[model samples]
Target: MIVAVASGKGGTGKTTVSANLARVFDAEVQLLDCDVEEPNAHLFLKGAGIEEEEICIPVPEVDEVLCDGCGECGAFCRFHAIVSFGAKPLVFPDMCHGCGGCAKVCPRKAIRETGHRIGVVGKIRADRVTLIQGRLDVGAPMAPPLIRAVKARMRKEVPAILDAPPGTSCPVIATIGGADFVLLVTEPTPFGLNDLGIAVDMVRDLRIPFGVAVNRVGAGDDRVHAYCRDQGIPILLEIPEDRAIAESYSRGELIVDSLPRYRPLFEELARGLFDGGSPSGNRAGYRPFKSCQGRFRRRENGCALELHGKTCCGLDNRCGKPPCEDKR
Candidate 1:
């Protein structure tokens, strides 16, 4: 099972939850930090170096020898990465998506693909977990390609947790794609609530099972709590605002490591996600409501049903289409 931990904005404890959750799991788990642009989970996990590899993408390469000044390649380019002028095409490697449309449409066959280095994917070994993190090259505008490379290393049978980048953009989408569930972390402030709605919308559109985790719970007003209640989004686990927790974070320590008392809380959250019910019997949030028609078992002991009409039919992950709705 793949569970993705994400947030609508930065500094909301998204990676904090992801790294610690993986820490709670057994050695079969893999902790993937897909925040390629600003991957900092490695600092928290502190794994021993295992392996590193350079990941590259294909960009347009011009073979001037086979060229004629055909505007076809330029015209077919959607990103405007290539524009032909006077027997040559200006190539902007950064803007290219590497669709290879220009090369296919080129009548002169002057354009082909060449390797472009965008980032590196590194593997690290913690005590019982393998940490995989992707780092984009400095000033690299695109991250989806490298994010894809990082996700490609997941093992199908083992449980994998992805610590996605903040926000609900292409990078986040790329990171959370094909996940069994997503745990969105947000604060209780106005800004947090605003972006939380956007992130919730994106996950619902993707048809993935998701829930919300409010960090720094008491620091802000009850509006975020009220919002979750009104939306029927379950409150998985709450981390109260504590000075020691803040100090531990500053020193790059895991919350569970610093405060072993909270290990049960993280374990409950993970169990709730995988067991088809809310953690600790709080089933008010997004339920895993598996469709009886899908691969999931139908027995009440094995399957959890939802109050809504949601069903999973092996279409997407849940029902081949979006199952959750945002009435709020």
Candidate 2:
């Protein structure tokens, strides 16, 4: 099972929860930190030397010498990465989507595909968890590619937890794509509620199962609980605001180690997601509610049952059609 721990805004203890949960479960787990632009999970899991691999993206490189100054390449590019205006074509590598259409349409074959290093993916093992983190090259505008590379390291049979980048954007979507469930970690502040609403909409649109974890539970008002109750979304777990927990976190100690009692809480979280119900029950097999019929599910055939009326597998599952809303 793949569970992605994410927040609409940063610093809500998403990484803390992810790391501790992996430790408490003690299963063959993989922790993928998909926050490519700013990866800090490695700091929490120290002494794990990350094996690095370069991440590159294809970019169009135009050979002016072979060009007949044809505008076919320019006209074919919808992103306008390549433009021909009476002279040698100008190529904007950053704007390119690497579709290869420009090269395909070029009569002289002047355009050739080349790779540009965008980031690096590192695999590190600590205890029972394998932590994969991606670091984007400085000034690189793209993050989805690196996030994809980080996720590619995940072993499907093992329980994997992805530390997603904060905010509802392409990077976040990429990170949470194949997750069986998403745990949105939030504080009880007004900003938290506002951003949580946006994150709820994003996950709802993707038709993924989700639950909420209220961190620093007593720091603010009860509005978050009120919203969750109103929306019928489950409040999975609550982490109280404690100075000791804060001090331990500051000292790079795992929550399960600092507060041994809370180890069961993290383990319960894993069970709740995998069992598809509240952790306080008889531990029976989980059954999805009728209302959640359209949510994504992994089939026995190793394919994903997308709500878009199609079964998909591999990376192609990413492009499955959007969910069709039920008018009822």
Candidate 3:
């Protein structure tokens, strides 16, 4: 089971919940800090044997010798990574999404792909929890590619927890895209409630089973509770506004490690999420959608629910598994 810990905003105790949850599971869990731009889960895990590998994305490279400046590559590139009026096309490495579309559409095959280093994926065997995190290179514009690289290293045999980047943006979507369940951590303040509502809508749109974890429970009013009640979203865990917890966090300490008595809360959360049954009432084997091109298509009976792409029947697609590799 893959549980993605996400939030609508930053500094909402998302990492705090993720690290504690992994600690309680011990060696039974694999923690993936998918916030490539600002990965901090490792600070709490602090395990040894840290190894890292440089990650790169393919960017289009033009072979001027074979180039005819047909402008097809430029027209094909949606990101404007390549542009040409009549001469050899100008390639912008930073703007490229590395889809290889320009090379595929080129009439003369003048375009080739070259690696552009964007980040590094690090692995740390921290005690019981295995920490895998992606750190984006300074000034790297895109993060989804690095996030994908981090997820690609996930050990499918073990339950994984993805510490998603804050906000409901592309990076957050990339991290939580294929998660089995999503745990949204929020605070009790008005800002928390507002962003929580936005995050809730984002998760619901993805059709992923999700629950709420409210941190700093006593810091604000009951508006969060009221919102959850009205939305029928379950409040799985509540962390009290304790000063000791804050102090421990300031020192980069795990709450469960500092306060042994609080281990039960995380253990119960783990049991509720994976051991007994998911809040969605579906087991791990149930994958809601199959892949078709770059999008996900849910086939039930004869109807199809296309996600993140245009609606289409399964007829034209050789639908097999999720996260369909775009061959375009």
Candidate 4:
């Protein structure tokens, strides 16, 4: 099964979960870090050597010498990548979607397709995980092409985990498009719950089965659980706030490597998510860590529910709050 690890906000331990799970799986696993903007999976799974392939996007080049500057090409470009003024047609390679519409509409046949380097995809192999990451060139506006290049390396025989970019945007969609399941990582705070709701809606809209993994469980409130209960989103794993894990992460160390015992936890998480059986005993019902005290300050008196850094009230604020945050 191809599992995608995604989050609505950054720093939710999405990569951490992805790397650890890949290491625990017995079969050969591929880890595709589709977060071309900022990929960090390689840091955890160091490889001896990485095979790199340059990625390029098609851009229209107009042979100005061959023809008069007709406005037909400009009119055909829906992205406004090509603009004509008087005798010169200006082309912005960054804005081009490579649709080749300008070439088809060019009456003078002056337009030709040219390649523009956007990024590079690197394939690296560790003990169990084969890492594929896309590194977008500086100032490159498009990421979908680079993402596609990274996913092309996927091997269907073995299960894969795709580390998708944060947020419920186009990049996230591209990464998780065809995955068998999506694991939404979030913190226990209000911001986490808010973003989780948006991500949950996005996955539901895409018709993909999804589960939630709460990171830094003790650092925030229990609203994440309440929301999950209300929405029927399975709570797959809850990682409590631990300074040891934080210190190890600061040193670019994987949690499972630093604390070997945690490997079993991640393994169970994977099984509970993919296997047909019910959640195991180790993966019991969601419970808040004892240390999560004042992290979730009560937003209002007499209300057991507390709000973290931000609350999703589904108002003018774009927190993407679920319909229940306000009712509570």
Candidate 5:
């Protein structure tokens, strides 16, 4: 089973949950830090025998010799990676998505695809877990491709945990693709509640099973709890806002290793995830109601606007489709 730990926003302890869960998982597992832009899981789960591999994506290159810029390739490219005004097409490799559509649309077959180095994927064996992480090259135009390379290294036979990048965007979607389950980690703050709803909607759209894990449980209000309860989403595990936990994290130490008391919480999280239900008797294994589908809009109070039957929200519409209504 591949379990993904993700958040809708950054600094919500998503990686913290992922690292600790891998530490206490009873079975052999592989942890893929799919947050290629800023992978920090290695800081906590350190090991030797680190191996690295180059990752690349295909970009279009126009051949000057076979010249015929009918502008078909340029017109076909929605990203405008190729542009032509009845002249030789200008190829912007950095802007290309590597779909190869530009080459296919070239009337004169003048366009060819070339490998463009984008990032590096590294693997290391740490104790019981194998860590595979992708690091995107600086100035790289994209991250989904690099994230895909990291996921490609996942051993299908072993249970895998993916630490997805924060937010419901292209990179996060790429990382969580094909995951058996997703664990949405969040704090108890209003911001957490808002983003959690967005993340919840994302996983629901993908039709993947998911539950909530509230970190910093003691700091924020009960709105997060109310949100979960109202949505019927299971609360798998709750970690209190503790200074010792923060200190351990600052020192790059695993919570399970430095603080034994918190080990059981993560162990329970693992159990609930793999078992398909909350072992603590809280509601689990419930699919989010599709009818409750809503787009996230930032309110002054940081509450998520669940617009039933509405397809879009102004700023948070990462689906790339036209908004049904611009409720900003």
Candidate 6:
């Protein structure tokens, strides 16, 4: 089973669930920290021998001497990584998607693909589990390539848990794309509930079987529970708010290791998710939902839904609501 642990917003304990899941998982497991831009899984699973490899992407390199500043390359680039000023072309490596369209379109054949280092992938072993993570170079505008680099090494013989980045964006989708199930992690606060709704929309759209794990319970009211109940989303587990959990996290200690009492809780969560089916059998886009009493509703060829008498993205995110503050 390949499960992607994600959240619609950051600081919702995605890494907490991912790391602890690896620690307690009964079978041989691998953890792929796909949050390449800001990976922190290493902080907790430290002091392990790591095998590191560099990850690079191909970027266009222009041989200025042989080329006339033609505009074909610029026009062919949908990303506009290369711009032509009459006959002089300027390349922005950061913006390049490595499609090689510019090089292919160059009339003078002056463009060549060059290796550009974007990040590195590290494989570490701790407590018999493998921890694989990617670290994107600072200031690198791209992360998907590095995310793919980390995922390419997934151990097919064992179950894997992907620690994805926060937010409902490309990076998050890239990490969770092929996951069999996604365990959405959220807290029990107004912000948590709000983001959880957004996250639900995302997973439903992708059609992956999912359940919510309410972290930091008792930190807020029962509104989160009410929302989940109203929507018929399964509440997989609830990690009550605890000061000791925070204290242990601050010191880079695994929760299951630091608090032995919590071992069975995570173990239960692991068994419940993987027991449903194998990765190949589960697809994120096949699940059913309400509001439309079925699949996402479409009006005028665009996705839309009504919630609390308000029309918004079919995902039910209260986008117009005021931003969530750091109540914690």
Cα lDDT computed for each candidate against the true fold = 0.75, 0.74, 0.78, 0.75, 0.76, 0.76
Q: Sorted on lDDT, highest at the top, how do the candidates line up?
A: 3, 5, 6, 4, 1, 2
Model 3 clashing residue pairs (backbone): 47-126
lDDT of 5 by residue, 90-132 (tens): 8887888889998897878898889999999999889878899
Candidate RMSDs in Å, in order, are: 8.6, 11.2, 13.3, 9.2, 10.9, 9.9
Q: List the residue pairs that clash in candidate 6.
A: 69-87, 206-284, 206-285, 207-284, 207-285, 208-284
TM values, all candidates: 0.83, 0.81, 0.83, 0.81, 0.83, 0.82
Model 5: residue 22 alpha-carbon error in angstroms: 0.5
319 Cα displacement, candidate 4 (Å): 31
Q: Which pairs of residues collide in model 4?
A: none
Model 2 off-target regions past 4 Å? 75-80, 275-328
For candidate 6, write residues 1-328 as lDDT tens digits. Answer: 6889999878999999999888886556789999999999988877485799999999988887987887898989888888987867888989988888888888889999999999999998887578999999998988888998999999765778899999989899989998988888998788888999999999999998777777877677767767776686755556767798999999999889998766655765665555422433223222422222222222112211111122222223222322122211
> Cα miss at 227, model 5 (Å)?
0.5
For model 3, where is the 10-residue window of minimal lDDT? 299-308
lDDT of 4 by residue, 86-180 (tens): 68799999998777889888888999999999999999899877999999989998888889888988876666789999999989999999887
**Per-candidate clash tally:** 5, 0, 1, 0, 0, 6
TM-score winner between candidates 2 and 5: 5
lDDT string, candidate 3, 121-208, tens digits:
9999877689999999999888999999999999777778899999999999999999988999998899999999999999999999
Runs with alpha carbons beyond 4 Å of true place in candidate 6: 276-328
lDDT score, residue 295, model 3?
20
Q: Identify the candidate with maximal lDDT.
A: 3
